[model samples]
Target: MAGPGWAPPRLDGFILTERLGSGTYATVYKAYGKKDTREVVAVKCVSKKSLNKASVENLLTEIEILKAIRHPHIVELKDFQWDNDNIYLIMEFCAGGDLSRFIRTRRILPEKVARIFLQQLASALQFLNGRNISHLDLKPQNILLSSLEKPHLKLAEALFGQPPFASKSFTELEEKIRSNRVIELPTRPQLSRNCRDLLQRLLERDPDKRISFKDFFGHPFVDLEHMPSGRSLEQATALVVEAVKKDQEGNFSAALSLYCKALDYFVPALHYEVDARRKEAIKAKVGQYVSRAEELKALVNSSNRALLQQGTCARDLLKEMARDKPRLIAALEVASMAMAKEEEGQDDGDALDLYQQSLGELLLLLAAEPTGRRRELLHAEIQTLMGRAEYLKEQIKMKETRWEAESMDKDGLSESVRSSCTLQ
Candidate 1:
């Protein structure tokens, strides 16, 4: 992380042997831990430069969520470390890639096979929701296949595909494939139609309305309480806290799982303080990088609308760009090129088009209407945008209305009352 306040060199303790994958803000590395066993683990390395305050807070929230969840379907966090510039999260290495890759390679899996995985996933969800934690991002990439091999043996010879063995009966082929592959097929459990329906409810998108333990696990699909575990919840929390404390002391990215452990033990106020301090530290550090950008002015102008929409932390980052206001203004000048003709009062087709596009960006920022000290400045910007959008709307009659209220006027006519883009 090349920020101004604090930028640390990457850690040298772990030997990075292979690239695992890249994520939105971090890269995954397959590395060997420096401990006695020299165990291989996947490290998720996030640069302080990439993490905004919101992202930092989200990371902590995720840690707290994971700390309380004890399920076979979920991946486990092993450790965390922070260097001068980067934070490294040591986690369970799932040799089998995420569910998305598996689904992509195999296309539609057999209903029975999919059901088994779904059952496991539902069990995990059931456990989390029991504790009022929701997995906001629930997609195939986050849903990992078991590191443990499945037990099912191959039942029959390949039908459309060529045989692995040149000479073997279908029955003998089944026996050979079963012996060769560690996996074995299990007898598919018969699920009632209602149970299948219940599974869909558990996977609902709306976090608030999603099914809970009371829904699917009024009678659970599986017995989570009786599931095997190497350590009790208390023991796990202790280990996690120890790891977190070590990472915090070493100035490494503290393990999210450990934060969750600490949260489990501490009061809510304490947890909030710990999280807030981390976020503040991240913001101060990131502001330094933003300040040093060569295109600081242009970057600020271009990012203004987005910053307004995202609010608080983004606004804070933008405030730091004042150090290089000249550069930022230069960048904004480049950004305004497309609107140059419109600004000059030209009403040509190109000018109209530019005006409309610029108005959309401006209106989007206004629509968010963020608060704090920047509220008045943001309001002025939004009003300027709305004035432009209103002009374009008159010129083009851009047939725009949505179920959600347009602007903040609520008492006016809605779609049911009239049909000609009426404001309410």
Candidate 2:
């Protein structure tokens, strides 16, 4: 409900173009500058009378926070104005509408499109979390679009004071919130396995256990940016070529290992690719490579079975022959990867132990190596892993310092989520 002075007005220095929309707090309009600039901005006007002390403070705090942060993924606050009756916030105009409207109108999205949005959201959240701020409410509805056909999201504040589900009573919603249970989420069928896993961590019921950006950002799903590219493509292709050579020489086990490495490079390349034709070509290569890899796996497995029948287990044979250089290299590489992944979160000391153990295995493997280009590569690999482990340690230490100073609870967060109307 508007106050008595809610009549539409042409404020000085701007021409009100049209009514955009209204919410519990304000009405948004499309407005243009007086000096003939074609660029338009959204003017959000809230009646001063409608704001209680808490609401007024909430608005001020939000404006202050937004002013300090500048991110491509967040809606920009262009300017502000205050009059006797109304407080107006001038914001960036996003013509592409919000994610909620997009989702509602289009029942399903392509997995790639969903992935793009998910990655953007992750980035926005990570940025905010890095700054020690929390959105408190993060859902599709809070995301606005800067473009529609090739959508680019600008994370906005959630619209508060609306029932999430029409069928559920307010009491039921309150009970769930009080108990820290996440409300039922809408189905996003387009999400792939890695994306879904990331979402689960983000939507964790207990805020304390909810994963930080450092943890999920590097997960296989979001880490696609680091996938093989340009110069790395040559390296990846060389690996595949060598695998084929080994297969032709009938060294099936070595071929299998090389094929796995090829896949390691190829998966990221596929993720980074944007051209439809290139992606299809990559898919074809992937299929051919996979078929060959499976054939090699079966051959390797059969050889192990033969060893087992001879009363010497393959695992025992590999362990007894510490001189088996390739076997030792493969095992250590796998173990190192597992150990580093464990250090992704603020776990208490266990991950550090794993990292040390991994480093020890790596060091022994390095010591066993005959010096050459391969040993140099191993040394570089070890240093990279060590850097990651040290970074994780620093992150845990910083998290501890911040944790001790403030409460992590977000249950009673202030009610100041944002809203923009769809109507024009």
Candidate 3:
């Protein structure tokens, strides 16, 4: 009997193999795009009738935002559709499951392994923050692994919490947040200092003082070894195409400029590329671009070469930037996160200590300032740090008292249990 539509629902070009997951609002499916490419894709289907106006608006806004963003660690939205009663989001497929499952299976990963995940998250965060978008949902469940052997993250399913596809007033959530409540993670003593520091910053409750993307990428927790550090293949290919077009038009100098930039982008592709054949292919492209640039440069007049050199060779500017230290930014980043932890009633004296250390560094920088105006600016920052430090002292005391009480309660429970066992 064909009672409740036993056959799978067809979405024209896509063949939905199996239901991947179902939540309050939307259900995801593993699909193959039956277009010219026959590409593997994930399709998120959400019934429009089930979503309220706010949810619909949020979904549209998110889709627009996702369209603008492109990074290896972030999930890609290939296509979208408004087909009849449901909205479908075509996205990249990662079969290795999400980080929550990985965590559940292995408990906590080793710091070495965990570093890769953190770096990927940081990279995704950096990308989002650059576009004035906060992930607001950066948990294990949101981070999907591609494969364990080559664990590239594809941060996904960033809907607003477990769904009834309903949008409720954030009155209760806001009140708790306003009351200096914490967003907590289990304290792992064995975690490395960098890992702990990064985790603390990421979970900082005060949005104003929370970690910034620029600072996060610089934190010691970022081990960029396994990280994908390249422009997308599409970008490099586009640049190459433009370079060739310019060369065809007999614009030697312009062609040389683009070829050089294309070659520049290709270097990182080779550096971070995992697949051997892909790496070699990129290397071949690099060679071709380099040869083209060299030939065009030779054809270019001396005046043209001299004029275009600084403008096109961004690598020169990059080298200069590498030498400059962001000391003030670094100091502020540390102090800000520490102060955030203290204000949120979280960080047990440790944040207080870090704030003091960071404060000291700022004071040192202020003392070294050569100009009066700059010195005044530095002094103002120091004053703000001092204000936070004073507040943190009271919070630290409260935290200590709380910790002691908790310790006593645990000890009392253990002693009572022992006595009961003895009597038995």
Q: Model 2, stretches more than 4 Å misplaced?
A: 1-7, 152-167, 174-191, 224-314, 318-424
Give the runs in model 1 whose Cα sits over 4 Å from its true position: 1-12, 67-70, 148-192, 199-213, 219-424
lDDT of each: 0.45, 0.60, 0.59
Q: Is candidate 1 or candidate 2 better by TM-score?
A: 2
Return the candidate ranking by lDDT, descending: 2, 3, 1
Report the backbone clash tally of model 2.
0
lDDT of 2 by residue, 220-289 (tens): 5665343323444465588899999999999987787777666655544554455658756765776677
User: What CA root-mean-square deviation does each model show from the true structure?
Assistant: 27.9, 13.9, 19.7
lDDT of 1 by residue, 211-234 (tens): 655655553333233122223234
TM-score per candidate: 0.38, 0.53, 0.49
Clashing pairs in 2: none
Q: Which candidate is the best by TM-score?
A: 2
Kindly indicate the candidate among 1 and 3 with the higher lDDT: 3
